[model samples]
Target: MAVCLQLTTSNSSMCLCQTFTTHLFLPILYSAMFLTGLAGNVLSLWIFMAKISGKSPTHIYLINLGISNLLLCITMPFIAVYYALGTSWSSRSLMCRLAINVLTPVLHTNIGVGMIILAWLALSRCATLVQHSHGPRPSKCIKILPKVFFSRLRQTPFALGVCMGTWAIVATASIPSVVVYSMKETEVVEDGDKQTCYSVAVEVGGSGSQAFAVIGIVIFFLCLLVVLCAYMAVIRHFYRSRKSTVISDRQRVYARVFRNIVVIQIVLVVCLLPYHIYKAIFINLAQTDSGGNGTECHSLSTYVEIKNVLLCLAALRCSTDPIMYFLLDKTFKKHTLNLIRGRSNTQDSHSSRTECGQSAPYNNSSPKGAATHDTHSHSKD
Candidate 1:
């Protein structure tokens, strides 16, 4: 009787939570994120393509990241609809499958590509700084490492290879999730009224979901550790160099670059970490409590609510990444400003030309006649 009562209460809370999230909270959040992310990423793409002729490895990685984020943004409305409609959605099973498969793989792909590219970016930035530094006295082997590895990476073909490899590896790893996820009617908030698209592994009531969550957490931490170490090495190099009496312009430029890289990484962590941490805990507890293992449903409801909110927060990363580009990359900022300025200038020039033609059509079409008229008037005078 106690278990029954607890289950009932949990169900009621779940319904309320779902209603709130689907009706008001998520639509506003998703819409804002989608629009902002789309605009920022589109602008980023334009700058990368039009304003920049030569592409560095870091730039290439950033472009790829922008593309990934744009793809993620494109899927936001589909996700919003899924949550908002609950199980009442009348979409075909194929639409449900397409939405699940496309969204899940893209999310994983975004994370995978971002992590790999960021690590590469740090390495590439450090290599450039070391190459340009005047007071660097590393041993031959140590110095040669960046040249042999990262210098080659700066080449366009090599960067393309890296991007392609990243896509291939991430897609291969994400295939399992794509295959396992299916659309099923779940009785979480209603009597067979609420349909959910979820992983088959999740439905089997085993440790699979928990195991996957642990693996994801481990991968996330591993990449984060790599990024931190790489940036720390860069920072330490600059810090030690500060002891020198005279710092060159090159070193100052490196310092600015390092600051930008640090800010970008900080943004990345702030946007994504909470979601992963909360997800790991939620999966662990939810899986443990799946088989009537003496857990209160109220606590489970709270976990569900927390996880949903965190997931929404994770979506904010897409919007924040372009902001990072604007703040960090001087070239990107300059180009973006120029692009905006150029567009306005073109419009102004076009409007002036149009008005001039309308007001004095003969100025352009009959220059000889105007000159002849002036000559005749001079003769008359």
Candidate 2:
């Protein structure tokens, strides 16, 4: 969260207000998110990097997503501390100002990264399932959609490029916006050190900040639509597979795919949807209700609290993601179990030996062994 000051009639007119939510609730919520998110993401990354055998595109996507999640998790303590003690910290306090400048970008950046990665995961999985399916082609589901668009996402190299591109795009979009909000046009907050963190500027924000917010919300909805469409297409393609007289081995794989999609979709809806939706309303309200005395907070008193709460909900995904990974991917679950049980995964050990230029009795480095590893990984996907 950033410190905000309105550019209305006069900066002094705005009430730098505080409530139970800002003072008491935000710190508690952020602390919980930090503790859980840090643990979950660290564990997930360890499994992704060390334990899982196949470095498939989806796996690689997950790795990048975990990294982004960890980045956000690390910022939580700063945010918690900021809100927890903002009553005593003036708007001009160097530490609070610096933290806001740094972390507001981080919050936006990770949310963008998470959404884009989730979209990529949905599309990649949809492509994999459709390409391998014996049922009807994607033409039967979404006739306008191109198969070539999805094919490239099935490769690990492309996944890496996508993740890198996601970070660049999100950073480019987010950092500039944070600069616009916090650095430029900051005349309002410059008047005095008397303003606390709960000022009206913090609630509704300066008018200039909303321009990029509008663009970000548009992107958010577009990603949400793409995820839902891809999900539906995958369902349609696989629905026919399960209808067979007897379930094939591939159908069982598709069953796993179903669980994966369901989990991701649930995450998007449960965590991010409410925040974005209410954010849109708050933005619109802020834009329209600018006439009231900014001190009275006629437009945004209740809204700021709701938005912050829902934002915590959105951030909650980082904590929940590892649990979802454990349930959806057998490789992750198996490795996690093995690690916890204090046992080695023999297959992982064998693969590790081959990769490290060691001569194993069984040459798992052979072409056939390599194919087996990839095939098994894909099947798990």
Candidate 3:
């Protein structure tokens, strides 16, 4: 399960002092992520709906990605408010549950789903390129390979179904976190008036928390491996196929898609990998200290601080995705520019017509047929 900073100590009260993390840094970081993620995802969703009709698998995946980020972004401000209130939910247990239990897990779910989709997209492009280079059909002997089995991920309905399944998996996985998360009262210092509010559930040692953290880390690593393999295969294919006499329009589109995959992988490495690594380490340390054998609260505090910083880094993924969409997707870019210039629908229509005329020979729309290297269709949105 995704965790918020453990802001209160269970046994310490004599030297109680305000931590800079829960009071200041977290609030500031969450606020910035909230605003930036909100704007980016909203624009991304608008561009998708206006210019791309979910006709392509990538389009569908990105649309869902945008939605996930948007929802996650909405939760950020509430978290900021929570931290801004000195780590107190002010008796609002439901809000605390909603933020830490529901939204945090959803953020984790988004990362998993996005990474899988991106990796799938990369692998699909590589497979299609290979198919185009070799022959129209795969041999019966190797048709059952995982790559071949998932080749249809590029289809709209198939992608949608996979997305729905991803959400279901995420929801099921988060149930334990929701059930275990609850508010606990912290002791007041000498001359204290009221008890401080903090959640005490599963700060370190809970079967559910440990299980979820381990599972999340495992999922992240698996997805990372998939992404790395897809990238390597695509790069290898490009290297070997460079000497081909004729390059189809489909291959050119594949090249562009591969570049997008590369960028997304880079972003994932920067924004996500460190956090998961730290998460695993943090969980392990907590498990080790669960026995209460000379545990160091200062060390735990430092780890919690580092973990929160890493969480913020992971949150940057939501903000960066719309940037990825604008940078990598030509259709999205064109539509964004048009929107900025206050262009009329009629002008946009004209621009789309012009784009259709000069595009690559193969129609990139209809991802299922793209593998055959058909040149009749327009570029994918």
Q: Which candidate leads in lDDT?
A: 2
lDDT per residue (tens digit) for residues 1-381 in model 2: 433343334433444445778777888989988998998899989878886554778778889999999999999888888777765666677766766688777987898899988888878866665555555433354356676666677778899999999998888777677877787634244543466655556556766788888888889999999899888987877787567525355566656667767777788899999998988898888777753553444446566778878988888888888888777666667667767887756866764445433211122335333333323444333
Which tens-of-lDDT digit does each residue in 1-381 have in candidate 1? 111111133334222224365445776788788999999999988767655544545568778888888988898877677555534442335555565557656766676677676666666555544433334454242454655775564456777788888888877876654454432222123343333332122222235434655676787777777777766765666665555526354345545656676676777688778878877777767666543323533335445556667777877887888887776655566566756676675654454344334322113245343333222111100
Return the candidate ranking by TM-score, descending: 2, 3, 1
User: Candidate 3 regions off by >4 Å?
Assistant: 1-22, 89-95, 133-151, 183-205, 246-258, 290-298, 353-381
Error of 1 at 21 (Å): 4.2
TM-score of 1: 0.75
lDDT for model 1: 0.58
Instruction: Report the backbone clash tally of model 2.
Output: 2
lDDT tens readout by residue for model 3, 167-230:
7887786776555543221212423322223323323435566676788789888888887876
Error of 2 at 176 (Å): 2.3
| TM-score versus the correct structure, for each prediction | 0.75, 0.85, 0.79
- Which of the predicted structures, 1 or 3, would earn the higher TM-score when compared with the native? 3
- In terms of TM-score, the best-performing candidate is 2
